[model samples]
Target: MEALTTMKKKKTRLVVRKGNENIALKVEDIAFIYRDNTIIVAVDKEEKKYLCDRNLSALEEELDESMFFRANRKYLVNIQYIRGFKSFEKVKLEVSLLIPTCNHSIIISQETAPLFKKWINEE
Candidate 1:
C-alpha cells in the first residue's frame, strides 16, 4: 500500500454580499480587500464594493499568497491591480493601484517596503 498526500486548493471565488443578494465573485476580479470601519469590503477591478463575512486574516490565509499581498493591517492588495509604487516620505512606499481605494492611498511601511519590492519584481 502507498501513502497518499493532499494539498489544499487555493480559493478561486469568494461569496460576498451586495444589498440583500449574495454574489460569487472571482478572486481574479478583486482588486483589493480592506477594512472599512467595522466591515470587511472587497473591491473589484471595476470599483464595485461587496461585503465579506470573514476577517482579513482569514482571507489572507485562504487566498493565494502569490496573488495577494498583505500590504498593511487594513489592506490585502492584488498583484494584478498594482499600477506602480514609489518611495514615500523617505523610508515608506506609496503604492498606486489601477482601481482607486476608499482611503485614496495605500502606504507600505518601512519594515515591509523591501518585501513589497521583491514581490512586485518577482512578477
Candidate 2:
C-alpha cells in the first residue's frame, strides 16, 4: 500500500477581473484582500484594485499563512504591504499598510495580535 502525503503547493498568482478584462497578478505583488459589499477585491502594491471571484474565506484558505494574515472579517493583509501597527482600543490592534484601501479599515483582534507579531518577525 502506498501512502499519499499532501504537498505544500504555493500559489504564485491569481487571475482577477478589472471590468471585462482578466488580469493575472503575482501573489507577492498583492498588498491585501478586502470585502466591498458583495464583492471581494484584491489590491496591489501600486494601489490598483481588482475584483476577485473568490470570497474572503475561500481566498484565505488559498493564501499562504506566512505571507498573509486575516486582520478581521473583512480584510486579509499581506505581510509585504505592512507599514506599521499600533495598539488600538479594547485590546485590539490597528495596522497600517503601504497600499491603502479607501473602503476598509485594517484592524486585528486581541487574540490574533500575538500570532501576527510572530509572523512579521519571521524571516
Error of 2 at 34 (Å): 0.2
- The lDDT of each candidate is 0.91, 0.86
Residue pairs with clashing backbones, model 1: none
- Per residue, candidate 2 scores C-alpha lDDT tens digits across 43-63 of 898889999999988888888
Q: Residue 49 in model 2: shift from native, Å? A: 0.7
Worst 10 residues of 2 by lDDT: 1-10
Of candidate 1, the 10-residue stretch with the lowest lDDT total is 1-10
Query: What is the lDDT, from 0 to 100, of the residue 95 in candidate 1?
Result: 88
lDDT of 1 at 31: 94
The local lDDT score (0 to 100) that residue 3 gets in candidate 1 is 33
State, as a TM-score between 0 and 1, how close model 2 is to the true structure.
Answer: 0.88
